[model samples]
Target chain A: MTSHHETDIALDPELMAYVDGRLEPAKIAALEARLAHDSDAREAVAKWRHFDNLLNSYGRQADELPHSLKIAALERELASKLKKQHWRAIMLGTGLRRIAAGLVLFVAGWGSHAAYTTGGNMLASASHPYFVAPTLAGHAAFKLAAYQGAEFDGDNITSALDWMSQKMQHKIESPKLERLGYRVESARLIEVDDRPVAVFYYRNAENERVTVSVTPKWTEHGNYALRVVDLDDGVMAYWSSDQLHYTVVANDNRGAITTLAAAVQQ
Target chain B: MGLKSELHEHIGSLRRYALVLTRDPVAADDLVQETLVKAIAKAETFQRGSDLRPWLFRILHNTHISALRREKTRADAAPDLPEPIANDCQHTQLELKQVLSALDQLPEAQRNPIILIALREMSYAEAARSLDVPLGTFMSRLGRGREALRQIVQGVGRGKLSILKRKGDSA
Candidate 1:
């Protein structure tokens, strides 16, 4: 019998059940009769048994949980439960309960406003002095909403570049993104952690929007050479060259943006 | 017992699964912590009489998938070359390492089922239920995963196949 035939026999659920000792008594007897006659089926059963033994040996090497991690997790879980209980007790108290509810409503309203402005643009309005950059998912959600709401106008690319150069104290190169089938749309200057971030928006032939943000003089001290983050709306790729930090954000199609970033690096 | 105490009971199994999934101890700890936190937060969604192990595994699998997706995206975009696998180990360590390296090479879809069934010794029914897949699909994946693993481990001798190759190719 050929190897293909052997593979088929090995993958047979009944044969596997027999090897695993899962078959009924009658079924086992019937399979045994077949195994008596068919050398290929017997060989397949042997292989399955060997593989199963190997797996069992590996499972026996399962790592024991360290005391540090176990204690830390237990303490953290208890603390969190206590905090929740404390809040519940407070919420059930007299006048403070109403005040806390109103505070929650106020915070909810403010969160929505911070997330989006009236015209659906991300309120990237002011440069906060000590703003911690949001995760890539947060960035994608905000930037995606901004891309959809804002009109495409390639005319702003030059202004955006000039603004970046002036603020960052270094000239920024504009990669030939059009070569990758993306037409420059609009550009804006935003601040992250009080540092200048130049955002260039683009649209492809399929109308898929991409955002390339350049932060000059920025460096990631982490050991990872490339950092990719997945967001609800898109994906972001972060890498730093000698002169600038580049982030490519796109909805699902990261390859196109990665190519564009490569060109920018060159 | 409270939900916290109940969750605490499964920590060992959760950590083992996480360690096998992520080949990194630090990451395994983080994954376990995240899994437990999510379990506690969504405790109400879990049926009172349902088996907690499967529910916890489901949360862990989802979290792991998200992390893998992000890592794949990053690996694709980066230009740096992959580091070589170290060859300083003794023979037995190397053999065990090869087996684990091969296991790590399998795609998450295939790898998860094999780990659940072959290593964890979960029944087909339980493994399928934990992964929220049909029994037929789970079996197919497990079979294919095992075949691929067998090929990888058998084809390469000691210190020949680089673990980096599989991880890099995965991107």
Candidate 2:
């Protein structure tokens, strides 16, 4: 009898099955018997075992896979989505005039921006420095929306604000615009800057729309800042006060956003 | 529980698969996050009674592929093993890299079945269900992936052997 069988160097289908642990008990026994005396078969089995060990070792290390890195990535993605949703609300607005004013502030504030035309709705890039919210509440709201069970419906401004304030245990109010020609169109509790913030859509008589988004200020000095951008179609007026940030967008009405910002200040 | 909760349960697995795919913690997370976002956005489109894990895997795999295509580099090409997983696969490092690179080279068909069997530890029948392929197809792909890996490992060993022989001749 040949001590080392050299019939074929390649692994047969049956041997491959054995290597994969798919062989039946009797077939496994036969393979074991062949390996008992034949050095070639034994060497082949050792190589097969080495490969299995290597593949399995790699997979075993999966248990040590880090979860924090993935969580951080999740945070970045959620932040990006929140930013997109913030601009989406403005872009998908019902053709408001303040939207034009906000557009102006947006273009003037940020030198370069991308505006996507989507279904009769013009959306300014929320990724722009000005459009991106800085408040924790605003960021949180956006993140909440990223998960299921948080739906955004900005039908009624005052009622929604009241409900959100009550549920979130925080008082969120639209900017006091008693003197400005714009009235709050609707407000939705949204996320911006990783926090929950109320986005108030305001409108002037000509149907120009402005949005006053309010969120809990977690920044030091709790300062108020404003960003304005000018677009081909309109102007974007974004102003953040101690309490909230107001973005007034309009096409032809520069004076309206300025007037509203001044009034809200008073 | 709703689909969201059920999907959330697999977040850890998704992260692991992504880490294996991207080999970069940040990139892995991005893949998982993108997968979850897309899955949640299109949750309504998911058919009831389908395996949610595979669906999420499909999204994650696609996202990673697209990202890789855009970046034009493999995650493994990046600096190996961040602090967190630095010690995890260190013991069997060469073998691990060999298997991973071989997996990377596999076509989607062969790759999917092998991953399903090897990583997910699913049976042939279960793997077929997840792959939406017949049993025969799954078995063939599994066989092909194994054979390909064996060839790759052997080729690497041969190259090493030739290098050693050259050193001996020079000596």
Candidate 3:
């Protein structure tokens, strides 16, 4: 037995239900009829709906996606300098906090600064970094680039991908770049910004070093267009699909990174 | 898509709500990052094919709560939790600052529902579950919170909005 006051208290939530479209179609018609007579109820509905729209709109526009924010940068030195300081600071802080590290060396993977890689004409068609290789994704890729020869956490490719799939929400599969003459030399986990990302180091017979890293991004959508930045000594290409954001960097751009990027996409 | 990927899809929404909840961009970023790490680390505990949105949100909600408890412990005096951060407000647009500012006036109990349903586009039921409240309780808070939000928002009133807590729903 619901009293008049209880009904009065409930009416506003019912009206809110109407605004949210959660009220039954039958209920909405009756509510609308009552609201026609009730000015306050009508205003509440409008206010609820208006606030909803305001928030949703702000959410869509303000949250910067990695894909949309890739404005070109002519200068990579500032980014690299910041990158070094950022990682070095994080490394200084990470005192053996490992989920799975049999290896003794927790060398601050921060010392490995991103190779300076923004050329002016190279970005005429391609997207360049607003903060070249400094955003979390770029930082993960470039940070790993410096952590080469940091003990192999996984002895082989299968184990490495398996370890990553276990540690990360994104199931990172091993890229088969071996067909293009790139083999996974070793795999290891490195912490960037206090989050762990698995880094794979690939070396071809020609002594060319190609590095690949995968990090998860909070995205509105996973279809970020491939963006590339040319380093003075290397190239970095990155893209996203599903939940995983991939970065491929090579000290020597012998089309091996390109081949690996294509294979990783496949 | 697998289980983790489904959870990953809500990352942006999670971050936005985190920002709304904490109002400190740095704290919000930390909350989101910690939430992701926890979800990914505890993936098996999640049921397969279930709505990961609410589940992921629950993790974030609980993480924020735990952080608060820890903060309370660490500090000699905790800053009043619901008080909005002094506004630098560079992250969102100038126009929407009104809504964000209005939201900051709310208690977490009230603010959570609006943010979950409005910004994250979650259903009422899902929002309720995310905050771990009964459906009726959620609706009551939502109704009161929404009304208060309207009054305090741009052009409504300069009068501060304060909806008293309903006994147990003390956020």
Candidate 4:
């Protein structure tokens, strides 16, 4: 709203309004009449008009760009978007596996070690730093599994291994253990220190259900350590390898799980 | 389909301004792309229902300045002036190149205002908003930019020796 007739050589804000046709009608008429008659005003109006034309020319030239540049940019953006999606998928799978493992471990203990190895296959040694052993049903199942004639449920083993393999960055197979006279019944994933452990259940004809668990060594930790626990007619063997740690629990005799372990090692 | 699409429509104006600012299509495109990439990645920063064109131009301006600074330190970078000063002064094409070089040599504060007013057709208000400055400041810059360009172009047209001397000193 300032006046155009400033004393100094300063730019007149009203000049822009005048050029843009935004001035009041009376002001515009006066400016136009002055511009037509006065030489300086005429020169200023011509300069502004020429500047406007140049701006329009530049705008038009800029608009006529080739299509190739835009397409290339869009392609690059799409590829990065696809890569981001792939990373998201992998992260989600890892998260689900950890959550599933946590839930299983929570249920197994339920706040008491006694609750963890119920039905007495082989009790865990209180002295050992690592594993708590399996119970009677666990031991019996393991024995039957060791002999190859055992039949047990094999639900969720496929999914558990699928998830475990991806999480551990290693592979696990239940049917491969079938050659050792053991068949997986139910396999559940457990987490220790945020790493996944695959627990496989097997039952033999002796009605002894054994538990063999395999987990990534990186997921567990430490060197090759084996613990053997003998409890009320049941035995449990715990060992580990470079890639994975394992636990086998069985009953219906001593050294039965040892034989099964030997077969698994072969 | 949303803000991104709408903003993309302003690329033409951005490219035009950049072309005038840099006077090199390849360099202009690079600045424009950097501006758009920064805009899209930080799209959340944009306030709702605001004019996107000015924001995009501001980013383009900042990017050009940063690139120019980096280019200064880079060895073997071509100077804004064309090389092998063609002895053939009669060629109009060479004259045009000389003019462009002069435009590039102008100070950013002077050059930018001219480009926004002359090349981008921005209102003083819009240019001020884009520049995050007051309208009076924008007009002053525009006036100074025009006066400086007029002096440079006038010097170029009079004779080769004076213009070449100015170019050497400016470069």
The best candidate in terms of DockQ:
4
Tens-digit lDDT track for model 4 on A144-186? 2332222324866666667768876889766244533345666
True-vs-predicted CA distance for residue A179, candidate 2, Å: 58
TM-score of 1: 0.45
By DockQ: ranked, best first: 4, 3, 2, 1
Location of the lowest summed lDDT over 10 successive residues in candidate 4 chain B: B73-82
lDDT of 2 at A47: 67
Per-residue C-alpha lDDT of model 3 across residues A44-162, encoded as one tens digit per residue:
67877878877776556436634211111201222233323332332233431231131111111212332334563332333543222333333334344553323353256676676
Model 1, residue B135: distance off in Å is 1.1
Off by over 4 Å in 3: A1-11, A65-266, B24-26, B69-95, B154-171
Positional deviation of residue B134's Cα in model 4 after best superposition, in angstroms? 1.7
lDDT of 2 by residue, A1-266 (tens): 11123224332556656766778887888778877887765666566556666655454555676556555455455434433333344334354345555645644553443232222222435543333332222322333345222334445556666777775567765566533445665456655444555555556553555555555555542433454455455555555554554555554344444554544433
Candidate 1 collision pairs: none
Give candidate 2's error at residue A89 in angstroms. Answer: 30
- Superior by DockQ: candidate 2 or candidate 3: 3
Interface Cα RMSD for all candidates? Answer: 12.0, 10.6, 11.6, 13.2
Candidate closer to the true structure by DockQ (higher is better), 2 or 4: 4
Sorted into a CAPRI-style docking class, model 1 comes out as incorrect
i-RMSD of model 2 (Å, 1 decimal): 10.6
